[model samples]
Each structure stands twice: as C-alpha cells, then as structure tokens.
Target: MLPVFTTPPPLGSGDEIAVVAPSRPIEESKLQRACDRLRETFSLDPVIFETATKDWEWLRDNPEARAEDIMRAFEDPAVRGVVAVTGGDDQLRVLKHLDPDRLTSSPTRFYGFSDNDNLRLFLWKHGIVSYGAVLHPTVTVDPELHPYTERYLRRAFFEESLGVVEPSPEWADEWFDFETGDPREWRENDGRTWRGEETVTGRVWGGCFSIVKWHLQTERYLPDPGDLDGAVLALETSEDVPLPREVRYTLRAMGERGLLGRFSGVVVGRPQTHSPGLEWNPGDDYREQLRDEICAALDEYNPDATAVFDVEFGHCSPIAPLPLGAKVTLDPTVRRIRFQ
Candidate 1:
C-alpha cells in the first residue's frame, strides 16, 4: 500500500505564514510588495526568512541553508503555512540536505510550483501533501490577483476540499517583467477539452515535466514506481517551452522506465507555447499539436490510461492549486475534475 500522506491543516485569518526561498533568491522590493498584499488582503502575517532576500551568489552556494529554511518553517510552531518566494532552476541541490522525518513530522501547507516541484515531490515522498501553484514573485505580485487564482487559492488554503475544478474565463500566456513594471495582460479563453476514457479516479502525482525528468536523472526524490501504481499523473511543461518532440522524448523515457504504464490517468496542463525567443504566440494550432504529440506518446506506452489536456495549471496564469498526494476525480464525459 502507498503510505497515506497527512494533509496539513487549513489556514485562517490572523495566521502567520513563512516566506522562504527554496530555489532562487527573491528581490527585496518584490518580496515587500507581496508581503504587504498578503497582510492587506488576507489579514495574515507574512514572515520573510533570511534566505529569501539573500544575494544570488550566497543562495547558489548555500543549498543547505535553503533546505534549513524549509525545515525551520515546518518546525516553527507559529507558522500556519509556508509559501515560496518564487521557483528557480536548481532546487534539486537542496534535496540532499533535507531530513524526511522532520518534514513528515510537521507537514505544513506549502505552496509553490515550477522548480519548487522538487520540494512538492519531496513532501510527497515523505507522505505529506503540498500545494502546487502560485508563487510570490509571479501570481501574488500582480497589481490585482486574478479572481480565478484568488478563488482557488482560498479554497486550497482555507477549505477542506476543492469541490470542482474549472478553467478561468480568460488566461494569460505572456509573462511581464514585474521588476521593470510591465502591465499585466490576459486573453479570452475558449475553454478546456479532454481526450481518452470518459472517467477515471486515482491519487494525483507529477509536477513540472522538466523537473520530473531531472529527478529521474538523479535517481533520487521520486517514490518507488510501485508506490505510484494507479496514480493520476499530472504533468505540465515550464517556461522553457520544450518542443513537441522533446516532450514526447521525455514521456517516452518515462515509459521505458515502467513509469507511464503504472498510472490509470493523465492530466496535462496547458502548454505555454510562446516565450522570449519564440517568435509566434502558441495559439490553438500549436496547442493541438502538443496534445497530439503527448497522446501519441501515451498511446505507445500506456494505451489503457485515460488522459485530459489543457488543464488550468502549470505555467499558465490563473492556474489552480493541485494538492500533491491527494485523490482527484477526472471525468472527461462531463469535462470536470474534483479534488477530494
């Protein structure tokens, strides 16, 4: 049997949440603005950890300190939850220094994604459920938080269950330079569509696809393949915006390792097609190509598993918070997902 991870308690008004830099160092100005927003909007106190605003050189050199900040936040009695300043490229370096026992013993609510997926999966390996969406520098720093993002964030933090998952009426693929004061932008969302079997339910697993690939390379952090049996694999590409062929190659690698066939279902987040170097916006056709490529890979590896596409998570704006290690019901017939 897979070990049952304990769900951390929900947050409430007046609670203190620690802000830590488990990946890249945070900008002092951005951190202050986010902290102020947290205080004003949620009536909660934001306690910034020392490492959150440390110099990039110090942060890069001291992976142990980053690991320690996470440990201390979980161990701290005053902290009700923990949130990351932002996600970065090298969080895997911090994993070797973390104590699994300490994390399991305290199991505090953690919110982050992208590179922080390392910590999310680490918490999962230790039987602790953690939230996987939104970060201080990204979603929280917005002049006005998207209503869809705010709604799900509230449910993930304050409520016992996220009753239903739905796509936002609109979404944003373009990232702004918050440091340089670029204005936020959004485009109309047509809606989400699914493929594969009509319905399937299982415990959730997965994070940023690139990070998961990194975990496989290290041969650490991931749970045994047996532990993931019958899981609903949730995957999303990052800002790097890997090509369709690259995505297929990565999934094919997982299939070769006997990982793909173990899951009963798959939920892939909407692909971020456009980035700084990419000339064209990733419009409908590009998304369709991504879906086809992913489905083709899944067909070759895990034909029996159901799959859903364009989920409102990962590198997209107004993403939903998925609790790692929790059960979720995916119904393609009705095009609905409900978190238990």
Candidate 2:
C-alpha cells in the first residue's frame, strides 16, 4: 500500500508565514507589496527570506542557497507556512540540493505553482501535501484580491478539508504587469465541462504540463510510475501558452512512458490562451479545440479514464489551490469535485 501523507496543520490569523524564492528572485517592489498584503490583508506576519530579493545572477549561481532557504523555513517552528515569491524557469536546478528529510520532518503548508511544481513533487515524494496555487507577488500587488482567489486561499489555509470545487464566476485571460501594480481584469466563466463518465476518487498528482515534461526528461523528482496508479492527474499550461499540438505531444509522451493510463481521472486547468505578443484572441472556440485535443490524447492512451476541462487552477487569474497528494473526489456525472 502507498504510505499516507500527513496533512499539515492549518494556519490562523497572525501566524508568521515564511516567504522564499526557490525559483528566480522576485522584483524588490513586488516582493515588498506581497509582504504588505500578507501583513495587512491576511493578518499574517510575512517573513521574507534573503533569496527572495537576491540578484538574478546570484539566484542562477546559488541553487543550494535557494534549497537551503526552503529547508530552513520548513525547519523553523515559528513559521506556520511557506509561500513562493513567484515561479521561474530555474527551480528544477534547486531540487537537487533539497533534503527530503527536512520537508517531511516539519510538514508545513507550502504554496506555489508553475516552476514550483519541482518542489511540490519533492514534497509529495516525501509524503507531504503541498499546494498548487498563486504566488506571493501576484496576490500582494493586486489592488483588490479577487473574491474567488481569497475564498479558496482561506479554505486551503484554514479548513482541514475542502468542501467542493466550484468554477469562478469570472476569470482573467489577460496577463497583468505586476511591476506596474495595476488592478487585474476578468471575463465571464461559462462553467466547467466534463469529458468522461462516472465518479473517480484518488489522490491528486501532476501540475504545469510543461514542467511535467521537464521532470520526465530529467528523470528527477518524479514519483515512481507505479506509485501514481489510481491517482488523479491535474494539468495546466503556463503563460507561454503552448499550442494544442504541443499539448497533445506532451500527453503523448506521458502515454509513451506508460504513465498516462494509471490515473482514474484527470482535471485540466483553464488554458491561458492569450500571451503578450500573440495576435489572435483565442476565444471559446480555441479553448474547445484545445480541450478536444487533450481529450483525444487521453482517448488514445487511457480511453477508460474520466477527464474534466477548464477547472479554475492555473495561469489564469482568480485561481484556486489544489492540494498535491491529497484525496479528491471527481464526480463527472454531477460535474462536481470535492477535496477530502
């Protein structure tokens, strides 16, 4: 039997949350703003670790320091949780230096997505449940936190068990310039759609599809393929917004590795179809095409597996957190998801 992961105790108001950079250093202004939000909005004390504001050159050269900061934050009893400043491309380099013992020993809530997928997988391997959600920088600089984002954040941090996963009333397709500190904008969400039948209950696994490809290539920090049997796969694209063909090929690669068929179900986050320089607006039609492609890939490899599309966790705004390595029930018949 697979070992059961211990859920970290939830944080309350006034607790100190450590802010660290396991990826690239965040801009100083954005870092400070995030710290302010943690203090003023959440009523949590934010402890900024040194690596969060280091120069890009130093961050690139000091993977060990980045890993050490993570370990130190976990080892420190005073810190109730750890939050990543932002996701970056180089976090995979830091994984080699992290000690799994330090992570399992304390077992506190750790939150971040995209590049932090590396750390999430590391923690998952050690039987610790980490969160896939928005980073500190994005939350801090927003003029007002999206109610959807705040609601889920509160549930993740304060509740022992999540009730139901609901679609956000609205979602943002456009990217925000955090350096400019502008308020975010959003469009209406039609709601979630399912591609398979029946209910599937399993522990959640996987994150940014591109990051999963990186881990697959490196053969580093990934759970044993057998270990993921009966797990639910959660996947999303990043801001770079990989094309439908790229998405298909990545899932194909997983299928080729004998990895795709092990899952009982799959939950795909809303794709960020828009990028800075992309000309055409990829509206509902394009999203449906991407979903069809993903469904096709699943059909090719794991025809029996159930899949849900456009769930609210990913590069999009007003995101919710999904607990890595935690039990979740996906009922496609009712189009409902519940985190246990």
The per-model lDDT (C-alpha) reads: 0.83, 0.84
Model 1 TM-score relative to the real fold: 0.95
* lDDT over C-alpha atoms for residue 81 of model 1: 91
Name the regions of candidate 2 deviating beyond 4 angstroms: 177-184, 278-284
Report the backbone clash tally of model 1: 0
Per-residue lDDT tens digits for candidate 2, residues 219-262, read: 86788888889999999988777778788888898898899999
lDDT of 1 at 222: 79
User: How high is each candidate's TM-score?
Assistant: 0.95, 0.95
lDDT of 2: 0.84
lDDT (tens digit, per residue) of candidate 1 on 16-74: 99989998866677777778877876777888887887887899999999999999999
Consecutive 10-residue window with the lowest summed lDDT within model 2: 133-142
- lDDT minimum window of 10 residues, candidate 1: 133-142
- TM-score between candidate 2 and the true structure: 0.95
